[model samples]
Target: MKPLSTIVQAITGCLLIISCNHTPRARTVQVQSSANESVKDYPSHPKTAEELRQELAETEAADPAGMLLISGTMQENKILIQKPDLFHHSKYATDGYMISGIIRNKASIAPFKDAIVRVTFYTETRTELDHKDYPVYKYVLAQQVTPFELKVYPPESTKDFNMEVVSATAIRN
Candidate 1:
C-alpha cells in the first residue's frame, strides 16, 4: 500500500495538474452605440448652477408662494445659520439673551421664508440646560443670505448656545 504522505502528494499533484490544464474561456462584451444620439438625448448630466438659478427665478416669477410647506430635514440642509452674534441684557424686562445671525439659503431652486431657529443652551460642563425655537419672519431667496434676530430668556446656568435652522416655508412660486 502507498504511504500516506505519498498518497497525499499524488492527490495534490493531480489536483494541480487538473487545475492548470483547465483554462477559463475569455468573454468579450460588445456595447452598441448610435452615432445619431445627441448629448441632449441622454440628459444624464447635472444642470449648471446658472441654469438652476435661472430656472428658480422663472418658477418664482410664475408662482409666488407656491411652496406652502417644506420638510424639516430639507430646511436644515438648505437653510444655513452663519455669523451668530449673542448679546446679554442687564435688565430683566427685556429678554435676557439676544441672538442675531445670517440665514443663508443654499437651495438651488427654492426660496425660504419664516425660518424656525432652534437655540440649545448648554452649561459650562457641556450639559444642556434648555432649548428654544424662534421664528425669523424674513424672505431668503435661493443662493442668498438674510439677517435674523431672536430674543429669549435662558436659564442662568447657560454658558453657551448653538443655533440652527430647523424648518422654513419654501417659496416655490
Candidate 2:
C-alpha cells in the first residue's frame, strides 16, 4: 500500500511538471489600423515671431470671425462678451440682478462650447459682493455667437457688477 501511494504521488508530480513545461502556441492575430484618410499628419517646425504674426494675420483674414481655428490651442482673451445688458431687477417674489449678453468666439477658426461666462457683482467701492457664472449652450460653433443670461443674488452692499468670459471650453467628440 505504501509503495502504491508513493507511486500515485510521483505520477501526480510528473503530471504537474508536464503541464507546467507546456508552452502556449504563438497566435497570429491580424490588427486593423484606425487611421483616417482625410486626416494628415504634418511635420512640426519652428518659425520666427514675424512668420507667426504673418500666419496669424493670414488666418485672421481668411476667417475674420475665427470660426475654423483649433479651439483648444487658442490664446487667452480670445472670447469677447459683446453688447452685454446688465441691470438690477426687483420683483415681488424675487429681487436680484440680471445679466444678459452675447459671447462671441474671436478665434480665427476654433469653435467653443460649454463656455463659462462670469459676472462679478461689486459695491459702490468696487468691493466684491457676489459672482455668478453662466454656461453657454451646447456648441458655440466656430466664429459663432451665443447668448447667456444670469440672475445673481447680490449682497446688500451690491451696487454694480462686471461681466466677462471666465473661460470657454471646447467640445470634444
lDDT values for all models: 0.67, 0.59
TM-score of 1: 0.50
Q: Any runs in candidate 2 off by more than 4 Å, and if so which?
A: 1-91
Task: For residues 114-167, write the lDDT of model 1, one tens digit per residue.
Answer: 877777889999899998887889897877778766666778787777777677
Tens digits of per-residue lDDT for model 2 on 50-167?
7776666455434422342221111112223343446633323344545556666666445556666566768898989888776655566656666655555666677676666655
| Clash count list over all predictions | 2, 9
Candidate 2 local accuracy as lDDT? 0.59
Worst 10-residue lDDT window for candidate 2 reads 69-78
After the best TM-score superposition of candidate 2, give how far the Cα of residue 133 lies from its true spot, in angstroms.
3.1
- Candidate 1, 160: how far from true, in Å? 0.2
lDDT of 1 at 118: 78
